[model samples]
Target: MDRLEKMLVDIRAFVAEREWEPFHDPKNLAMAVASEAGELLSELRWVKGEDADAHCREPEARRRVADEVADVAITLLMLADRIELDLPAEVHRKLVKNREKYPVEEWRGR
Candidate 1:
């Protein structure tokens, strides 16, 4: 199978192995995604621009960020799978919508 499909299948198996599908409702997954995103944000909240860049360069800090990001990604994948969404298609669709909302020609380099 393709990488994305395989990832989804793996996530499904992981949840099933834990008997977590019952708790993997849309709202729960959405909340988990938001909570994980907050954790990810917390990693950078205390650091300013240059320092934030350097913080992520540190091994431990980077590992923490990766863990938080993985949490968000896992929840998001579960949510999308629950809703039978074609995530790549949805992302492309959203980008098209966003391009219209924020046209690059109007805001480029500014």
Candidate 2:
């Protein structure tokens, strides 16, 4: 299986081991995604936008940020699996729509 599929299999086994499937309905999974995303945002909450990159470059700060990012990704993947959503296809479709909405020549510099 591909990497994503393997990850999903592992996640499923994890939840199964803990009997978490009953608590991981779509709504709860979506909420987990949002909560994890909020935690990720909180890591940079006090940082100025212009300095954000530099702040994240610090080793400790980078580790914390990376942990939050992983949490967000894991919860999002769980939510997608619960809903039977095709994340890769949906992301590709969204990017296509975004390109159409913001064509390069018209939006390049502005």
Point to the candidate with the largest lDDT: 2
- Give the Cα error of residue 31 in candidate 1, in Å: 0.5
Model 2: CA > 4 A from native = none
> How would you encode candidate 1's per-residue C-alpha lDDT over 1-110 as one tens digit per residue?
99989989999999999999899889988998999999999989969887887899899999999999888898899999999999999999999999999899997997
How much RMSD separates candidate 2 from the native structure?
1.0
Per-residue error at 12 for model 2, in Å? 1.0
lDDT of 1 at 55: 95
lDDT minimum window of 10 residues, candidate 1 = 45-54
Tens-digit per-residue lDDT, 84-109, candidate 2: 99999999999999999999999999
Provide the overall lDDT of each model, using Cα atoms, as 2-decimal numbers. Answer: 0.92, 0.94
